[model samples]
Target: MAEAAEATAKTMLGEISQGHLECPICFCRYKDPKILDCLHTFCLNCLDGMLSKQQPSTGKITCPVCRKETPVPDAGLPGLLDCFFLSSLVDEINQQERSLETQQQATTSPTCDACEEGLEVVSRCIDCEENLCQLCKAAHVRYKRTKTHRVTPVEHPEQKEVPSADLSKTYSPKCQKHSNQEMYFYCETCKMMTCGICATIDHRSAEHQLSEITDAVRSYREEVNDVLKKFQKSKEEFKANEAAVDHARNRLKIMVTRACSAIQAKEEEDIAQIKNKSRILRDKVTEIGKKRDDEFDKVHTDNKKKMERAEEIETAVTDLMQQADDFELLNLKPKVMHNLEFQKNLQFERVKHGESFIGFKCQDVVRDKDLGEILHEEKWKLQSEFGKKGDWDGEFNCAAGIACFSNGDIAVNDINKKRLSVFTSTGHYKSMFDLNAPYGITVTSHDLLLAHCEDHVKVFDKSHQLISKFNLPLTGTDSTDQCFISPWSNNKTYTSGITVDKTNQVALVDKKTGVTSLHSLDGSLIRVIPNTKMVPIDIITNKKRCILSAMYDESELRCVDVTGKVNVTARLGQARPAGVCCDDTGDIYVTVHGNGLDKGVGEVLHFDPQGVFIGCVARAMHWPFGITFSPSGELVVADYYSVKIFHRV
Candidate 1:
């Protein structure tokens, strides 16, 4: 008990302790490591890792060393979580080895590389003892049953893996928590085993099933030791690799010096030969060749001469000896050589890109700039914020104007049905809310959504949570009895518009006069933005910026910016443009009904900032009505009959 406590304390102190492990079974790290409830751990298969393959009963998993029977679990044994105890045990062994090494260092003769003392290599056994020369080895092997006896060659003390026998002397170990009770059997009923005395008194009538713990623990121990040993070896290597960069740098410099010396020597030799040829031709040009040929040869030869001279100077400056003092020496060498060759050749064409033996020139580089969103980041592919909708394979009746929530949910206004259903980004109908004649919808900073119904505007929080609704104040027009009444009256053609204000209040166009009425976020009607130019169709705001709806041609598609200034008025005309939206980059998109001009389905058009008519983005909508941009700016179109996402091409 004293020894166990001491071992535990020593192990606790040496978190960085080291040692190697070997499996008493297969001796490999070949199985998943696991620890049992017993704190005793091992490889799940290590027990079966030693099972006699052909025997059906090997599944019983008997211990290799003790032959105690261990019952396997019904679902098969579990793999290891890590052999914590084995690692601790290995650490104990390492500590002993370290102490042994310290002792050996003190005793060994410093001068003796081959022996502890200068005394003649003397061995009576001629086996493990030193100095057993060839003749002695023959005599040692001649003994019966001792042929090839373990003999140390007389040069050094034996270095071999020695299984620790001192483990009992120094390794004070702990019993596994579950096994501390001297596990004779495991009880299946109460999941607790009774001692031999208690087993008969309480569990004798088969209320419990029992398996021997000795075999199970032993088999597991072997597997645990194997994994711990492998991990320890890998950890040792990892620690040694801390100097990886320094090691790479030193190796690279050595290679560079060798390569440069070989290349420079070759270059110098070629230059010298060319110079000699050029001098010969210069001295006897008339006799050397035809005049034209002679002139060309002279030029080529002269250039080679110049290159050679430059190389000699370069070789002197970039000598390998300089590599030690200057880290940038390698970087400069390539540049110097390139400049010398460029000067010698006189033209880049003659400079060597390949086969001509010339060097390289590193031209300056410039990064390409992004044009804009429509041309740059195609968000549909990059963003995970939006995904497909459900029942997307068939036509989706999107009457309740569709708006995309920032969290990838969609609020579709089911106009005739008066049902505002919240669909998941995947088109899965999550929940629904009731609204009368809901038409247009937009999201807000407070997680609330602004929606337009018939005569009143409804506000909903992110999860279809109700905030409040606003009813239009009465304003008589046309005649006394025929004049539009409040909320639900004549001339009350609320064209589905909702806008937000500086105080985070929401506003909407009265749809009758194009007057912009602002309201508190809590749905209290504040007032109208008097003198609005056109009747409003839809409203959108993102707190920092706001968009007011108005007529652009026959379609209601004029976009307003943060300062209540008009930025872009869309230029798409088809059946009758109904809904419009602008991305962060101020590009406008509008949905229109089926046009007689194209004789096709309704379509969506895109326009650049300058109102330069970009082009039609998407087609084939039965009656594409309300359009909105996702937070990421992908075009979300609620086709009066179906909803689809389109990229601004």
Candidate 2:
């Protein structure tokens, strides 16, 4: 009985579900009598046929979904089920359209509804739902919208617009209790902004900080402007500094040019002086020579006249003899002829009574035998060889002085090597001497060596045996003060130079307070030579009286003749002179470094007896220090580094 009941319920449910969906035609469930007012329920193709009615001659119809009225009516039968989903879909479409409209409205946010203007309004009107500012608040807008809206101040911290759509919202921009209308500036001390009423009532008696906005703005501007001004000034100062550097560079260029010009001018002046001196000497010498020639000519002429007179007497004698012979055979007056000849000669001699005076004595001016080796231009060119080598075939630190031996050996003071090195002329090791920190070296003709070092002068014999030492007893070490030992040693303790005169006279550097006593071979102070105001850099005495001492850093290379009178002078302006030597002809050669470390500029200048500057013998050498002429007439230049040999021309 229950199963029958359930089946009956299922059948009824099916029947109800079948016609449950409504039809557009009758607005009711579909029935077997299919009607839409005309009883059409739109069954698939039949519904389309009915819907697409002929549109005035064309077959077209309005769609029910679009709410368009059909132009034709069809007599097709349909059920309610087919149009059910279409009705439900139409309901869903309408609902979704409303949701899309809502989303667009939310996306636009709240904006003014009334104005056409696009200005950004931070505040809004309550009643009119419009946005504006204080100046644009028209009373009519509020008054007209008063029925439905209200007006008030807006306050939204981050958002510029009013907190709500209505301008009637009130926000306290000021204190309400004070009822003050103006915005009082904040006082830093009080840390608050007060209304006028509050200022006069509550804050008037309180100590507080306050300032006008205009004054603060102005002060800030001034401070910033002051910093800007300083920056500008600094920029200008930097430019000035750069300009000064450039100016100094230009000045240096000018100074260098002027210095060069000065040196060149000096050369011209020196040459002119040499020419003048030579001319003067030539004039005097030529005048004297002409006088001698005139005297000789007169003597010759007188001697010829005497010879003629003798010849005439001879002829007269012959004639007298012949006449006597003729007078003996007829010879008359022969005795008177010979006597007259003699008397005539005597008379002529008396008339020309200057017999001795007629001839010149020239033995003093000429005829002196020059036996020494004379280097002439025709014989050989001047050749020089020099080199600095360690004394003991070891390393040399720094070469301070150098000297060469006669047999191709050279000696150098090795300040760094701490000993001297004797090397062959070709730079081969030979032998060396041991000594203290040596500063100077002088070689004697007999192979005796003299080296100057700290406070003592060590002397050595030819075979390198220690002979003895020379030193001044005065003992005080003051750099600024004058040295006493120097005057005694060199006649000046400034023993920068030492040379043994050919006669073995120990010559010391003087001209400064350093020179003093120079010892003899016997070890006693033979002489205490006094130093002059000048310091001699190098001292050399041939011993016959020609003491050639070259002065460093001075213009004069002075020579003292045999009479002790200093004559042969060489004037060199601004020349850093070093060593000097006198060749056989009395011609002197002086080495000029021409500015220390100015290696390429060093040259050797020759001077005549009258102090004439001949051209450079050699140039472009490394600080040519010591110079000497070899017995072979070769000039050896002892440079600080290398020794060069130039053949004397």
User: Quick one: best lDDT, which candidate?
Assistant: 2
lDDT of 2 by residue, 120-195 (tens): 4546766566766544555434555453455565554332221111212222245556655543444445544555
What is the TM-score of candidate 1? 0.35
Off by over 4 Å in 1: 1-400, 473-494, 501-503, 525-527, 541-546, 550-553, 559-575, 594-600, 647-649
Which RMSD values do the candidates have, in order?
34.3, 53.9
TM per model? 0.35, 0.37
Model 2 lDDT, residue 30, Cα:
36
lDDT of 1 by residue, 515-574 (tens): 556667665666545445455445554323556353523554555553456655544444
